[model samples]
Target: MQKKQSEWKWQWTKVYDDSKWLFTEWIYPNKLKDFKGKTVLDCGCGCGQHLNFVAPYCKQVTGIDLNTPRIAKKNTRQHKNVKVVEGDIAKIRLKKKFDIVYSIGVLHHTDNPSKSFNNIKKMVKKKGKLIVWVYSYEGNFLNRTAVEFLKKHILLRLNKNFLWVISNITAALMYIPIYTIYLLPLRFLPFYQYFQNWRKLGFKRNNQNVFDKLNAPQTFFIKKSTVKKWFNPKEFAKVHISHYKGVSWRGSGVLK
Candidate 1:
């Protein structure tokens, strides 16, 4: 389990160190509102990117991850209100609760995503919020199927160095053609805007994205209904579940 988790640490550390941009807000819609003065907990926080984004608005932001605490700490070093801790989402215990417990693109990589969801839920204060985003089975059906097989039969078995090389190669194959199209006058078309975002991310970040997707050992593509069940109506006041271009499951709700 530790080895499997360490793979993600190495991949994300490389990405964080290499990428020129820093993401601050939720990538999906239904973003949090009125975070000012609230306490936030970012479970599986990678390199403290989101923590740095939220720290200025919230009273405090705590970032926890099974690996990469050192990177996270260094990334958020300038923010006195931000704390970085090394811990697993499924096992870490804290006495305090936060106004918001957010775990995006993290839970589904766990050995048991449902267990991690329950553990994260415990960190939310009563009437507070729990936000999550997981890879979805409904969207990207064909592409996901192909990658799933590669992940199980090839990528997971490769050494870290070899896997990194293959991931970058895969990124090149994907980006070259798509970005070529993006640069043409076709980009002015309505639907071309979708692929335009990828071009805007630049080559290295796109490579990192692909690496993170294919290299992880425990990537579970979950169903929307399964995610809805994860948030029991008894525990949450209202739950909102949606998807982004059929690629991810986005959910947010206030704890009861």
Candidate 2:
């Protein structure tokens, strides 16, 4: 699984947009200012981008992933204070807990998302923050419908390269109506922003989400209430859901 995940990272970087706001500017940090001087643990930290988001604010930021040691080493070296480790989020040995533990767009990919949350709990301190982002079923209809159609009929049968072209073509046109609604002059609105993500722009996803190519493994989408049900108010205070729209479920929670 680790080897596969490393390959996945490599593939993702190839198409994944490094300059997109998805990595740099987060929806909401749940008292973003509170992150300063606090300990943070980033689960499923790919090539080490999110760590850069909170690194300046936190006293220490630790990123763990199943990516190759070389990539991890490179990330560690690039960021003087950042610490990157290679390991499965399901099983890892850590002596200390963190003030904030986050797993973004990772839980739903697992065989058992609830189990992933359970394991993360062991590494989070009492009254600590737990941030997560997973696919949502009742979030947006248009986006969900488009993705379902794309994945089921379009992506399933077509090769990754072909699918990339189709998805982006569809995404580029998506900006038209959006720009119109924004009241921006349709002629002036830059469609380039839609492709600027670098992923769709470059027609990439080299190894990330490779599972989609293998057989389109079973994926799950949960409701907001279901996520809230996972935590007891006594031990975990349910923070407000951050409003985020992504290719998938974007911002969901900041559990405390």
Candidate 3:
């Protein structure tokens, strides 16, 4: 288990510097813009990529991750408003509460995503916001199934070095379809929603995304209904759930 964790850490560390806030506005929209003078906590802030993007706007930004040694501290060292801590989502405790607590593409990677979600909820102040993004099981069923099967049967068995090779190869192969869609007018068609975000990223960012998906040791797919239930009605209000390209889920709500 430790070895697997280390592999995951190394995988993320390789891309830490390359990480980009590809679509902060598209994902968080008005929420990020409204974060002035607020305390923000980026749970599982891999490489502090999102922190780097939002730190200028927030009064303070705290990023905590189990892979802190690998990425967090180094990535956040230059940012005065940002502080990086090493901790587990399911066990970390802090006295201060954040005005905004968000974990983008983070919780689903944990062994116990539900527990992580509940734990992070405790860090949000009453009337504050909680936002999360996770892989969705709905839509693109066949493609998702095939990727899951590969993750379970093949990718998980490979070491970090080998997985890096495989990820690059996979990224290269993806260009075939990506370019095919680019050459045709498929991107303009509403029916081809799957690669729309990818098209916006161009090749390099898209390749990094492919590596991110193929190299991670753990990945979980959640349904919109299940994600909605993760936050309780008594504790959360005005919950909004949105699905992107049927491949990802973005959810946000105010703490009551």
Residue pairs whose backbone atoms clash in candidate 1: none
| TM-score quality measure for candidate 1 | 0.85
Q: Which ten residues in a row are the worst by lDDT in model 1? A: 17-26
lDDT of 3 by residue, 107-151 (tens): 878888888899999999999999888888776475467877887
C-alpha lDDT (0 to 100) for residue 166 of candidate 2: 58
- Per-residue lDDT of model 1, residues 1-256, tens digit only: 3333677677766777333232322333434346788999999988887787778889999998887888899989999999988888888899799998899788888888889999999999999989888888775565467878888888888888888899888878876667566578763443354455566677777777788877777788888888899877988877878765446777888999
Q: Write the per-residue lDDT of candidate 2 for residues 20-120, one digit (tens) a residue.
A: 35643343456456778899898877666577677778889888876543455565565666888877787776889999888877677666777777788
Better of 1 and 2 by TM-score: 1
Q: Return the candidate ranking by TM-score, descending.
A: 3, 1, 2
What's the candidate order when arranged by decreasing lDDT? 1, 3, 2
Worst 10 residues of 2 by lDDT: 201-210
Q: What's the lDDT for all of these models?
A: 0.77, 0.60, 0.76
Query: Pairing residues by index, what is the TM-score of model 2?
Result: 0.70
- Minimum summed lDDT over a 10-residue window in model 3 is located at 17-26
